[model samples]
Target chain A: MNQKTNISQIAVVGTGVIGAGWIARCLAHGIQVIATDPAPDAEANLRKSLQQAWPSLEKTGISPGTSPEDLIFETDMAKAVEKADLIQENVPEVLELKHQVLGAISQACRKDAIIASSTSGITPSVLQQGCHCPERLLVAHPFNPVYLLPLVELVAGEKTEPAVLTRAESFYKEIGMKPLIVRREVEGHVADRLMEALWREALHIVNEDIATTEEIDAAIIYGAGLRWAQMGPFLTFHMAGGEAGMRHMLKQFGPALKLPWTKLEAPELTEDLKEKVINGCETHAGNKSVTALAAKRDEFLVEVLQLAEKYWPEPQSIMKK
Target chain B: MNQKTNISQIAVVGTGVIGAGWIARCLAHGIQVIATDPAPDAEANLRKSLQQAWPSLEKTGISPGTSPEDLIFETDMAKAVEKADLIQENVPEVLELKHQVLGAISQACRKDAIIASSTSGITPSVLQQGCHCPERLLVAHPFNPVYLLPLVELVAGEKTEPAVLTRAESFYKEIGMKPLIVRREVEGHVADRLMEALWREALHIVNEDIATTEEIDAAIIYGAGLRWAQMGPFLTFHMAGGEAGMRHMLKQFGPALKLPWTKLEAPELTEDLKEKVINGCETHAGNKSVTALAAKRDEFLVEVLQLAEKYWPEPQSIMKK
Candidate 1:
């Protein structure tokens, strides 16, 4: 059964970076958004963030009848979820907080309304623990600057129903998003776990002073990172193996895996390592602040993704495997 | 000592994909190239490859006085190396063949002429063995479509002189390439090691039937892979850590790494896995041939890199860190 009609409106709880981005995206897609946050100055700050992000969305061309003014700010939790077809919980990553927030939203929204959490680490099963209807609760994790990047991992908890996942996927697609459904509820889901592996190795490198932060980034931004933006490692190796393909590459390079090459054990983030890591990033930052760097990152991220869409066109066709 | 007066011309041996790419980039840079290969149709094939690659290179703005006619082909190894100031060897990965070709090229070129090998795995130390003026031998490994990607890992062997490395760096910079000088000899250098780690993990996923090749690619292209193009894992984590930074993230996520999240062992490439891998790529590739995909890849690569250059502006400035 289609639990709700069209996702004409969205309830966004916690107006932090992720939540605000979701609000901006929904509003741009012509969905009325009721966003709530208890923090002081939350309304003013969120409006600023939305104003900053709106231009990028405008470039992508927002839905008809959509405007930043479509966003409604609410401090009352019950009022926020009153008329939403879907509610996305973007509370802090603490489990108890998510449980409380998700429970409240589930109780207030339509009995059939789907509730999704943006928790990156905690499994949805745990977040749905005290909700009114756990079957309607699931995880829909989006990358930062959520308005830009299309990847959103949708993890259905053990209690979550299959229909909710299908409906959520369709709704996300409606909002111009690519939703990857993780079959199993592993910690960090699929994308974050993969990100964790490389991140840990990166920490080890900086910890031991094998390379400075700048050198490490250079190795990627110019080399393997370029290939990653368009394809994952498997298809790249298939291409790199010349005519013989992946089998030949595996046979020849398999032995190196056993080498003590990349450190899996993350070195302690001691004060010394912290200074080095921070300083290295500061140097790379040059004259810009983190905010400036983030602005620049958002700008490039959109351009690169647009180019990727133009080149690959149909990410879903590739995801069909 | 200045290794050579100037890099007026380059001698390219082996007309494989890597070699042809090198020729195209050089010709586009307005450098005269004496290219040699023994394959019966080497000239015709090289011309066809260059013709296909020219449009992309032209968009990058070809150098003044550079034309496709500048590529001179020779079947005779000594004649090819006679007038060149630099020799780039792209022979097959076999050790004996590399030794034979590099030694012959060294004997033919001027004593101070720099001879660089484009070996992906083999270390420069072994390639220098039995070569004339072994001090000039070094590994300048480049990514595929060598013309488009700015990364070139310059590895110095035991016998390679320090000044040769400096001169090579300057020469490559003048030609508009980013060369990363490896501090010590290592198999696969830095870039390939990172690529290999991710690749080995990808193979495991497919082998276990956890995900198809396309699914694996989707996990990356739409997710973490996008982050990689501009920032590596370290800085990205720095941002992900919120106001607390990398230490906070490491403390939060360190324990998850101990779990078997990503496979360290390279899965045996069984026939079943190979068929699955190949089939996934073919489907993703759709109606395009490998050559067609390569063309599409090249077009987007140049466009994306140009966009990246515009946003980042000075990869060299960042590389300075």
Candidate 2:
């Protein structure tokens, strides 16, 4: 919708949940979306999802002239992508399927068209294989409910052109997204790796009966979850270090890395790693002191706590039987 | 302040960050606090921290008759805990220091008084080893900025009485907390385990140069972090699975657990673990269908995204140089 981005037409190569979400988000932004899926009921399902998502999108605000009718559905992948300036592939996670689909999309789409995958786990370099114009392919992984959440991780394949990433970044930003360009290609990208670590540990806890799903949910909704909404673990720990900030935090709690706290093995707290963490936090804090940052955090928490109370589900009794 | 809980005077056994947070939260609830610390400047630091936390607490809501002056300071741990209905121990994480401090409080405090440790890692049973009346000692771990965050993980030692947990739960609820009674005591308990897993993975990402801390934080704030404020991972994933809910989710993404998505090894997703997770999500979902829950989540995300934009830091350019 931003006239400068020059990406008015987007091809959505799958119409499942993530695909449908992408379609709805692009449509809400007044971008013409040509969606394709092989499933018999894909169109009906996609329409239902769009109807469900539109109200929330409307509340959030929509690009002028935006409407669900702006979207067009096709059963043929080649037809769906041939004309689009950008093709967003949201097919299943199977590697063979992705290679086959991306290959088809690459061959059929225009030479300059950008190819982005919504693959959560596969590395961009791995996905770039078997694709025509591999330099145009990159990973633009988005979280669920694509229309509302602003984060979209942009990872470049080894063969990807920097210009392609730049173009993709601007286009996503114009659609109201925060594009985080990953430094290197890795399995699960950035967000999913962090989430999977937590998920794996959570599975361990459940398997061991340390807590029920409800109790685990309570643990998050009421505590760290609230803080994480604003700050990541590093910044949170920096504040926890008090006035000295992360310098004192690493000194104090760095020993806990050796403790059997999480099943995941922590990277050795080498002097280099320590400096990286402390420096990263100090840099992120900018000119603000830990006290000043804590004040801002406190103010934010007060308002968010109230906002959350209105929306959070009723507290389930977590008493041990 | 809730007359039914029968807890009025609370002794804070340390005046560090966690201890000061307890003092501020208790004082905000109109509960008289007796705080003690051996450090030369403990009282001054505690007072300063209380002043910093009070404004936010006031904004959130303060109990009737709440007064900062209601608190008294003592140099001796025994003196501080004596005559108090509840004693909160927040000494340094050193096991020896905690054992010594907890022992003194236990010997001096009322037999019926509840003794809770704010220890983030050490198990309650380990701390109770040197204490008199170990039945009263329990771990009541709270998150940072304790005045606002509502979650408190309560873990009881082998010697602890069931009645103590019951009484502690009511007291925490009265003071505006969601008490998650951990089923089994682990090194870091429930919330921290989840957090530590994520933190460890984040550190690996940073160390490996996959992303910087700011990029990692952005990954959260713009996506999962927004959702976590209202729903934890289980319910969030349930909605991600579409109308079929968590059952469909497990069938789809369960294989990712076997993939090297995270450093932490996932537990074997046997039939039992799968059922536990599926059943837990269903029970938590109650009668609400996944579609209904997704709608609620979408609504919450819309409002939270707006709220977060006001408080979130200006987006740092995460592009690779």
Alpha-carbon lDDT of model 2: 0.89
Instruction: Quantify all predictions' global Cα lDDT against the true fold.
Output: 0.69, 0.89
lDDT of 1 at B144: 68
lDDT of 2 at B108: 97
Question: After superposition, which runs of candidate 1 have C-alpha atoms over 4 Å from their true positions?
Answer: A1-5, A129-132, A242-321, B1-5, B38-41, B129-132, B241-321
lDDT of 2 by residue, B126-160 (tens): 99897998999999999998888998999999999
Clashing pairs in 1: none
lDDT of 1 by residue, B23-79 (tens): 988898877899999999999989987886676677656787778888999999899
**Tens-place lDDT digits, model 2, residues A1-321:** 457768989999988888888888889888899999999999999999999999999999998888987779989889999999999999999999999999999999998899999999999999988698899999999989998888899999999999999999999988888899889999999999998998889989999999988778878888988988788788899998987888999899999999999899999999998899999888888888988998999989998999998888755545322
The CAPRI quality class of candidate 1 comes to incorrect
